[model samples]
Target: MSLATSIRRNLFVLVGLGGIALSAQGAAAQPLDSALAAAYVNNPTLNAQRAGTRATDENVSKALSGYRPTLNGGISAGFQATRIRTPGALTAYENLWPATFALTAAQTLFDGFITANSTEAAESQVRGSRETLRNTEQQVLLDGVTAYMNVIQAIALLDLQRQNLAALEQELRATRDRFNVGEVTRTDVAQAEARVADAQYGVSQAIANLSASRAVYRQVIGVEPGKLTFPASIERMLPSNVDRVISLGLSQHPAIKASQFAVDAALFQVKVAEGTLMPNLSLQGQLSQGYDSSISVESTGAAAVTLNLSVPIYQGGVEYANIRQSKELLSQARIEVDVNRDAIRAQAVQFWGAFEAAKSQIQAAQAAVAANTLALQGVREEWRVGQRTTTDVLNAQRDLTNSRSALVVAQRDRVVAAYSLVSTVGKLDAQSLRLKVRAYNPVTHYEQVRDSWAGLRTPDGQ
Candidate 1:
C-alpha cells in the first residue's frame, strides 16, 4: 500500500484514546469578529481613549467663548457707623444699614483676531484628537486579533500534544505485546515506555501554555475565551503590492494625520502669541441701585457704559518671549509630522515583509507535514514486515508530530502577520471593518457644544 494511504488507514484504526483527542478538537470555534466586537465595547483602554477624545472636543467651545458676552450680578448688605468731629461744634454720630445691588455686562469687540485664530487652533486640536482615537482603535482591534489567534494556536498545539501522547501510549503497548511474544527484546519495550513518558511531559507543558494564552485572551477581549474558532487566513486581503501599503500609510494613517494637525495647531499658537502685542478693544456696561436707612431712608440708582482699548507698549518682555517660544514649538511640531510619516512608512514595509515570510513558511510547513505523514506510514509498515526496527518507526512518528506542530505554528503566524500589516496601514478600524456597533463620533459632541450660548453641563449632560 502507498505510504500516504497507509497513514490514513492507520489513523482510522484509532478507536481508542487517541480518537477521543482527535474528535475533541474545536468544531465550532469562536469567530475573530466576535472578539473584536467585545474589545471595542468593553476594553478599558479603548473606552478611556474615547473619554479623552470627548474631552478634547470641548476645547473648541472654550476658545469660541472669547467672542461671547459675559454678564454678572452681585449684591452686598452691611451696617455702617460714622462719627463727625468739629472744633467748636458738638460731635455727631450716624448709624445706618446700607445695601447695594449691581449688574455688569462685558463684551470683547476686538483682540487682534485672537478669538478667531484660537478657535481655529482648537478645532485643529480636535481633529488631532479624533485621529488619536482612530489610532487607538486600530491598536485595540489589533490586540484583539492577536489574542484571539493565540487562543486558537494554543488549542491546536495542545490537541496535537494530546494526540502525540495517545499515539505513543499505543505504541508502547504494542511494543510490550511484541516482547511478550518474543518478537521484540525487553530493551525495545523499555525504549517505547520512555518515549511514552516523554510524550506525557510534552502534553503537560502544552496544557500550561494553553492556559496562559487563554488568560491573555480574557485580558484583551474582556472575557474568557470560549470555543475559539479556527481562523480563516486573511492572506488574500493583503494589498496587491508593497508600494500601495506604504502609500496608504503615508496618506491615511491616523498617527500621521494626528501629527499633521498638531503642526497646524502649533502654527496657530504662534499666531495667538503674536496677537498679544496688538491692540485689544472691549465694551463694558454696569447698573447699580443702593439703599440707605439711618435717620431717614434713601435710595439711588445709576447706570454707565464704557468702551475699553488696551495697547501693550511692553509687557515686562513676556509678550516677545511667548512669541519666540511659540515659534520654537511650531518648528518642533512641523518636524514631528515628518517623523510620524517616516515611522509609519517603516512599519508598513516591516509588516509587509513579515507577511511575506510567514506566507512562505506556511507553504513549506504544509509540504513537510505531508512528507512526514507519508514517512511515518512507510516506517510502520517496514517495521511490521521486519525491514525497519522499532526505533525507526518511533523516529518517523516523532518527525510527523513535529511537522504537524510546525504547520500549526506557521498557520497562526500567517494570520497574525496579515493582521499586523493591515493595522500598519491604518485600515483596522471599526469603520473600515464595518463592525456592527454604534460608532462613536467625536463630532457629535463638538457640534452640540460648539454653538451653545450657555450651559454648565456637558453635551451628554455629564
Candidate 2:
C-alpha cells in the first residue's frame, strides 16, 4: 500500500493482509514471534542466566562427592649412609638409596546423613536455579515484546506527525494567499505559521522517540528491528478473568516455584548442619612398598586397613550456631515463597487491569480519531468559505493528530499489556508461545553432570 493510504487507514486496520504485510521496501514483515525467538536464542542476559543455571548444576556433583571414596598416592626417596661394627673383628661402611611408595583410600560408611542431606540440598538448589532461569527467559521475552511494539508505535506516530506537518504547511500557504487577496488578515497567516512550527517540533520529537525505540529493540531482541508485523491476538490465549489469571500466577509463576525450591534447599541444609553433631564412621586402607639397595635388604611391601569412627564431643559451639543459622535461612526461604506469591498476584492484577483498560481506550481512541478526522475536514471547508477562522482549522488539525497518536499508543499498550500479563502468569516461554526456536534444556545439563565421576569439560565441551 502507498504510505499515504497506509497512514490514513492506520496500519493496524490492515490485519487482513494475508496475516503478513510488506514493508515500504517490499520485504515481508518481521513477525513478533520471530523477534521473540531471536531474543530467546541470542539475548545475552537470558543466555547468561542459562550459564548460571549450568554452574548451579555442578553443586550436585560436588555434593555427591561425599559419597565417593578418596584415593591418594605418595612417594619418597633419599640417600642413606650406614656403618656397622661387629665385636671389633669387622667394620663396614655403606651408602644406599631408600625409596617408599604408598597408596591410601578412605570410604565413608556413615556421616550422620550429612552426605544425603547435602546432596538433596544441592539438587533442590539446581531445581531452584532452573526456575530462576525460566523467570529470566520470561523477562527477556516480555522486554522483547515491549521493545518491538514501541518501535512500531513510534514509527506510526512519526508518520502521523509528518503528515500533520505537511497538512499545516499547506494550510499556511493557503492562508498567505488569502491574505494577499485581502480575504484574511496578517494575524491569520501568522497563526498558521506558528502552528506549522509546532508541527515541525512534533516531527523532531517523534524522530527522537523512534530512535530511542530502535535502540531498545536492538538491546532486547539482539538485532535491529526490520518492519515488524503487529503481533497476533493474544486474547484467545489469556485467562477468562482476573481471578483465573491470579490463580495461574500463583501456581505457575517461576519466581514462586523458585522460592519454594529455595525453601526445600534451605530445609535440607538445616538437616545437613544438624548432621555435624552426629558420629561419623569410615573405613581406611593403605598399601606401602619400601626399597633399600644393600647387600641383604631389597624391598618390602605392606598393606593395612582400619575401620574408624568419630563421635562429636563438642569441641566448640560452632556446630550449634550453624544449625541455628540454617534454621533461620530456612525460615527466610519459606517467607520468600509467600513474598513471591504476593508480588505475582499484584503484578497479575496490574497487568490484567492495564490490558482491559487498553482495550477500552482503543475503542475510545478509534471513535475520537473518526470524529476528529471529520471535524478537520469540516473546519477546512468552513475556513475556505469564510465561516471558520485560521485558529479553528489549526485546532481541528491538532485534535486529529492527537487522536491518531492516542490510537497508536493505545494499540501498543494493549499488545504490551497482554504480553506482560502472560509473563506475570509465567506463561511467556518458548514452549508456551510456540516460537519456532530450539528451547534451552537446563535439565539436560543437570542430568549430564549429576552422578558423573569425572570431567573437565562441560556438557557442551566448553
Candidate 3:
C-alpha cells in the first residue's frame, strides 16, 4: 500500500514487484528447492566436507592393514678376497664371489587385538566424519535459505522505498502547484522538497543493501538470484513446541552425533594405545640364493620359516605415556559430547524464540502498516484543505514506509529462523526435506575402500 493512489497502481512497474525482475540473463523464477539443491550439489564448502569424510573413510583400510601380510624383496652382489701367509701354507690366497637375492614375507598371527580395535576406532572416526558432513550440509543449506530470503527481503524493501519516493514526489508536485497558485506557502513546498530528498536517500540505501544481499546470495547459492517467489512456509515442518524442539534436537543433532562418535573413537584409541604394551606373534618366511662362489660354476640356495615373537618389557615408558594420553583424550571427547548437547539445546531454544519473535513482529508490523496507510491518506487530504501541514503528511508517509519494511524483514526472519531450527534438529538435509537431488552417500566410499588390500584408483575409478 502507498499514500498516493496513482503511484500505488504503478508501484509494481516502478519497482519490479511481483513481476519480471532485473537480474542476470535467465528466467527469474528461482525456487528455494532449486537453490538448496544447487548448494547441496555444487557448493565448494559442502563438497569439500564430503571429500574430507571420504578421506576419513580410508583410515579404516589403513588400520585394517595391520591384519594383512607384508611382503618385501631385495637383491645384493659382492666380491670377497682372503690372503694367508705362513712358513708353508697350503694355499697363499683364496678368492670367492658372492651374490644373494632374498624374498621375505611376514604375517601377523596375533597382536593383542590391535588391528581389530584400531579398525573399530577408524570406523568410528568415519562415522564421526559422516555426521560432520551432515552438519555441514545443514549449515550450507540453511545459509542458502537465509541468503535467498535476504535477497528477496532486500528487494521488497528497496521496492517499498521506491514507492515512498514516488509518493513523496507526487506530494512535492502538488505542493509546488499549490504554492504557484498562492494557496500553499513556499515553506510548504520547501518542506515537501526536503522530504522528497530524504525519501530518495532512503531508496539509495535500500539499493545498496539489495546489492550486498544479492552478492551474498550469489556466493551462497552459486548463482545470481533470479526473480524469487516466496516458497511455502515450513513452519508446519517444525516441532509444535519448544520442548519438542529441544527433544528432537538432542536426539538428532549432527553435532551431538559427531561428538558421540568421537567419544567412541577415542575409547577405541585408548584400547589401541594399551595394545602396544602386549606381546605380538607373527610367522615369517625367507628364501635366498648364493651364486658364483666357486670359480663361477657353483651355486647354493636356502629357505627358512620362522615364528617371530616380540614382547615389550620396557622402552622409556612411551607406551604407558601414550595410553595415559589416549585415556585423557577419551575423557575430553566424552565431555565434549555433553558440551555439544548443551550447545545444540541452546541453539534450539534460541531459534525457537526467534521464530516466535518474528511471528509477533509480523503481526505488529502489519497492523502498523494498515494504520499508517490510513493516517497518510487522511493527512494528505487534510493538507489539501489546509487542515494539516506538509510535515504531518511526510511523517505519516515515513511511518507507513517503516512499518511496511518492518513487515518484510519480519517475514524474512520467520523463514530463516524456521529453517535454522530445523537445522539445529539435524533434519534440514535433502533426505529430511525430500529434495529432488540424489543424496551423497559417504558409506559407499567406505564400503568400497575398506578391507581392500591394495588399490590406486577409487571405487568410481577416480
Candidate 4:
C-alpha cells in the first residue's frame, strides 16, 4: 500500500482510542475550526489583549472631557467662641454658629487648540489599538492551528513506532525458528534481537513525545484533545504566487497598519505639545450664601463671574522641551511603520517558501516510501532464499520504517506551512475562516463609550 493510504488506515485504528480520550467530554469529532473558536473566546492571553483594547477606548472619553464643564458644590458649618476681660469690666463671652454653602462652575473657552489636537490623537490611538487587537487575534488562531496539528503528528508517529516494533518482533521470532532448525546462524538471531530492542526504545520515545504534544494541545485549546478530525487542505484559499502573498502582506498586515496609526497619533501629539506654548482662556462662576448667629444674625449672598486668560511666559521651559520630545516620538513612530512593513514582507517570503517546499517534500517522501517498501519486500524474499543475509533484511526494514516516519512528518508540515503562509498574508482570522463563533467587535465598545459624559463603571457594568 502507498504510505499515505497506510497512514490513513492506521489513523482509523486510532479512532477508538481517541474516542475513549473524549469520553468525558462526550465523543465527537473535534475539528480544527472548533479548536480555533474555543481559543478565540477562552484563551487567557487573547482575552487579556481584548480587555486591554477596551481600556484603550476610554482614552477618547478622557480627551473629550476637555470640552466639557466642571461643577462643584460645598457646605461648611462651624462654631466660633470669643472671650473678653477688662480691668474694670466683667468678663464677657460670646458663642456664634456660622454656616456657608457654595457652588462653582468652570469652563475652558479655548486652550490654543490643545483640546482639538489631543482629541484627534486619542482617536488615532483607538484605531491603532483595534489593529493591535486584530494582530493578536490572528496570532491566537495560528497558535491554535499549530497546537492541533502537533497532537495529530505525535499520535501518528507513535502509531508508526508501535507498528515497527511489532514487525521487528515478528522478524526476530522467524530468525529464532531458523536458528533452531539450523537454517540460520546464532549471529543472525542476535542481530534480529538487537533490532527488536532498538524498535522497543523507539516506541517508548514516541509515547513520551505524544504525551508532551497532548499537554501543549490542552494548554492552547483550553481543553484536552479528543477525536481530532484531520483538517482539509487550505491551498485553494492561498494566493497564486509569492509575489501576490508579499504584496498582500505589505498592504494588509495589521502590524503595519497599527504602526501607521501610531505615526498619526504621534503627529497630533506634537501639535498638542506645541499648543502648550500659546495662550489658554477659560471662564469661571461662583455663588455662595453665608449665615452667622452673631450681632448681625443674618445671611449674606454673593455671586461672581470671571473670564481668565493665561499667556505662557517661560515657565521653566518645560513646554518647549515637551514639543521637542513629541517630535522625536513622532519620528520614532514613523520609523516603526517602515519596520513593520519590512517584517511583514520578510515573513511573507519565508512562509511562502516553506509552503512550497513542504508541498514538494510530501511528494518526495511519498515516492521514497513507495520505493523503500518494495525494496524491503524484495530483501526479505532474498533472505528467505539464502541470497541475502539477516543484516541486509534488518537494514531494509529500518529503511522502510524511516521512510514512513518521514512521510508522516512531511504531511504534517505541508498542512502547517499552508496555514502559516495564510497567516503571514494577514488572512488567518475567524472572519476569514468563517469559524462558528461570535466575533468580538472592539468597535462596539469604542462606540458605546466615546461620547459618554460620566460613568464609574464600564459599558459592561464592570
lDDT tens readout by residue for model 3, 123-149: 899999999999999999999999888
lDDT of each prediction vs. the true structure?
Answer: 0.82, 0.89, 0.86, 0.85
Give stretches of model 1 more than 4 Å off: 1-3, 6-29, 85-90, 177-194, 233-236, 293-297, 385-391
Q: Write the per-residue lDDT of candidate 2 for residues 1-462, one digit (tens) a residue.
A: 543453466534422222433235655568999999999999999999999999999999999999999999999999999998899578889888999999999999999999999999999999999999999999999999999888888877787889999999999999999999999999999999999999999999999999999999999999888767777788777899999999999999999999999999999999999999999999999999999956488998999999999999987899999999999999999999989999999998999999999999988987787677678777888999999999999999998888888887888899889998889888999999999998899999888999899879888988
For model 2, give the 10-residue run with minimal summed lDDT: 14-23
Write down the RMSD of all candidates, one decimal each: 3.9, 3.2, 3.2, 3.4
> What C-alpha lDDT does candidate 3 achieve relative to the native structure?
0.86
**Per-model tally of clashing residue pairs:** 4, 0, 0, 0
In Å, residue 80's CA in model 2 sits off its true spot by 3.4
Question: The CA-based lDDT of model 1 is what?
Answer: 0.82
- What tens digits encode model 1's per-residue C-alpha lDDT throughout 1-462? 666675565344321112222214455445678778888999999999888988888788899999999999999999999897899999999888899999999999999989999999999999999999999999999999988877767777787788888988888888888888999889898889888988989999988988898888888889877666655556555788889989988998999999999989998999999899899999999999999945466888899999999998986999999999999999999999999988989888888887888778867866676777788777877887778888987888898788778767776676788888788777888777767778888788778877877778886677
List where candidate 2 sits over 4 angstroms from the true fold. Answer: 1-28, 81-93, 293-297
Model 1: pairs clashing at backbone N, Cα or C within 3 Å: 29-228, 29-229, 30-228, 30-229
Q: What TM-scores do the predictions have?
A: 0.89, 0.92, 0.91, 0.92
Give a tens-digit lDDT track for model 4, residues 1-462: 765675455434432233323212465678888989888888888889899999999899999999999999999999999787999999998787889999999999999999999999999999999889899888888889888888887877787788889988989998999899999999999999999999999999988988898888888778888777668778888999999998988888889989999999999999999999889999999999998846456788999999999999988988899999999999999999989988888888888888788778767876676677777778888989999999998998898778777767777777788888788788889999999999999999999999999879988888
- Between prediction 3 and prediction 4, the one with superior TM-score is 4
Residue 292 in candidate 1, Cα distance off native in Å: 2.5
Off by over 4 Å in 3: 1-28, 79-97, 293-297
